[model samples]
Target: MSRTEATGIRTVLSERLLQFAADRALQTREFERRVAALPADSPARASMGATLSAAKAWEAGLLWVAWRLQPRSRIGA
Candidate 1:
């Protein structure tokens, strides 16, 4: 994915996260904890996970999208 694509994904994920947070039932800490519980490599991270499936899906997609857009740069090469 190009940088622009990554930006778009990030925007989407951020917006979704914000929406989840905005919900009266979801506390900030609870929302964050659910996000943290998702596997680092899991697509759910970008979405809701453990907390709420729908939210996880959206968040996971974002993370997946970002992973795609990330540049291949060697570290300490």
Candidate 2:
């Protein structure tokens, strides 16, 4: 691939990854808020906890993908 094309691809992928990370952060915050408002004895709290953990794992996977896509050095330097 040409240097220009490779740089463009990396830029696009990085931007998309940033957006995905931000969205996941918002979702996690909202989930925590909902879980906290639940009573101590509420059965739903347990399920929400599991969901939060899964969301975190998903985010970590996305980060790994982003790391792999990033340019290791100046693309054309």
Candidate 3:
């Protein structure tokens, strides 16, 4: 593949990853809202909170990978 083609594909993949990460963040927020409604000391609340932490971590990793996939500017372009 040509350089242009490779760059285009990377751009598309990066955009999709960003979109996915945004969607995941929204879902995580909703989960947090629901979890907050549960009694603070409820076992289910604790369990779901743990799951929420995992979701947040996954989202962060996705964002990091997407950022890495983005095209970098040339120093003297």
Candidate 4:
């Protein structure tokens, strides 16, 4: 593929990955809200806490991958 085509594909993939990361962040926030709403003594709270932790981890991984995929500036450009 041409350089222009390759760059366009990378840009599209990067945008999509960033969007997915954003969506994961929003989901993690919703999980946080739910966990906060539950009573301290509730048994479901423990399960919700676990779920929240997993969600946070997933979001972090997505964010890291997205960061890695981003283009870096050249030193002398």
Number of the top lDDT candidate = 3
Clashing pairs in 1: 43-60, 46-59, 46-60, 47-56, 47-59, 47-60, 48-55, 48-56, 49-56
For model 1, the local distance difference test gives: 0.60
Write down the TM-score of every candidate: 0.33, 0.82, 0.94, 0.80
Quick one: how many clashes does candidate 4 have? 0
Off by over 4 Å in 2: none
Task: List per-prediction Cα lDDT, in the order shown.
Answer: 0.60, 0.85, 0.93, 0.81
Q: What are the per-model C-alpha RMSD values against the true structure?
A: 12.2, 2.1, 1.0, 1.8
Candidate 1 is scored at a TM of 0.33
lDDT of 2 by residue, 34-74 (tens): 89999999988898899888988888888788777877676
The digit string of per-residue lDDT tens for model 3 on 1-77 reads: 99889889889999999999999999899989999998878989878978999999999999999999998778987
Q: Give the CA lDDT, 0 to 100, for residue 8 in model 3.
A: 92
Clashes in model 3: which pairs? Answer: none
Say which prediction, candidate 2 or candidate 3, comes out ahead on TM-score: 3
Clashing pairs in 4: none
- Provide the lowest-lDDT 10-residue window in model 2: 66-75
The sequence of per-residue lDDT tens digits that candidate 1 reaches over residues 1-77 is: 89768777766766665555455234544777766876799876765544465555565665565455444556995
Model 3 scores a C-alpha lDDT of 0.93
| Ranking of predictions according to lDDT | 3, 2, 4, 1
